[model samples]
Target: MRLNKTQYVALHLLMIFTFPSYPPYLIVAYYKPELVACSIPSAFQGQAQIKWSKAMITVNVLTIIPYALTALIIRSRKTSSFSRRLFRSLLLVMIFDVGSWLAAVSFIKLL
Candidate 1:
């Protein structure tokens, strides 16, 4: 499938926001849950909490790079059909980012 200029731009922007928009919530929720007026579940307190927070940060940061790359590739392209490799990369970015966003939001709600 080919994306027109508008779709390319919009998707790129959305991917770019994927990291900036959501990960900070996870980070904040990790460090100062009280500031967000939400507490981690009692079950997750102590060492478990710390471990979970570290893992969350690691995964979120890892996903950010690819999404940023996908966004950059999309932004630089001037054609109707981007390379198949880029399309695959973008698809993976969307899948991972969307999944991570959903999970983060749900976890934050628990906070």
Candidate 2:
């Protein structure tokens, strides 16, 4: 199903909320225990608010296209080779990278 601009907007907003795989925060939490406080890490200087927005913007801008494709593939009825190829690749990532499991489910739910 082709998404019109409004659908695309909705999809993107949904994706933005879902796509920031937990690894980054987890790493910071586990490895940098000192930074565990909600306060911004001094090294990451400047306001916490801007940093959060930047991370969200960076993740969505970089990943939205591939993620959209993944969602489309999951939602599609066809069993095309391209879909198999793309999904298989994603499955491989999902297999190797534990962090991606949530993303895989989120994409599936986009249908």
Candidate 3:
């Protein structure tokens, strides 16, 4: 389905905030678990906690790239249909994610 400019912008807004929004809350709750604070429950315990923490930290740090790219796409003079824009944005993020993942693994293996 084709979307107009408004829908295209909305798509960008949603994409920027979707998965990237989760880490902030998890970070807050994990760090500041009080009666008034949010709790992350016992599911994230022991080694699981460590792995999850690392993944969360990595995700939060890496999310900035896509956010910047989306903002650029939104503000760019070049106009494209919603599906094409969405596909390009998603493809860019996916390529970045995979490349970074491989790089991290390779770096870790060397160490």
Q: Per-residue lDDT for 18 in model 1?
A: 80
Summed over model 3, clashes come to: 0
Off by over 4 Å in 1: 1-41, 79-111
Tens-place lDDT digits, model 1, residues 31-106: 5344333544333444545565666567767766876786676768753565656677767866787676658657
Ranking by lDDT: 1, 3, 2
lDDT string for model 2 (1-111, tens) is: 999999999998987676555435544543532443342233232354345545644654555567667767677867778877887787666445544544643454353
Candidate with the larger lDDT of 1 and 3 = 1
Better of 1 and 2 by TM-score: 1
Off by over 4 Å in 2: 1-42, 48-53, 56-65, 73-77, 91-111
Candidate 1 or 2, higher lDDT?
A: 1
Give the best candidate by TM-score. 1
Residue 93 CA displacement from its true place in model 1, Å: 11
Between which residue pairs do clashes occur in model 2?
none
TM-score on alpha carbons, each prediction:
0.36, 0.28, 0.32
Best by lDDT: 1
Worst 10 residues of 3 by lDDT: 34-43
Per-residue alpha-carbon lDDT of model 3 for 11-82, expressed as tens digits? 989977886665555545456343431333333434544555577557656766776676577668455687
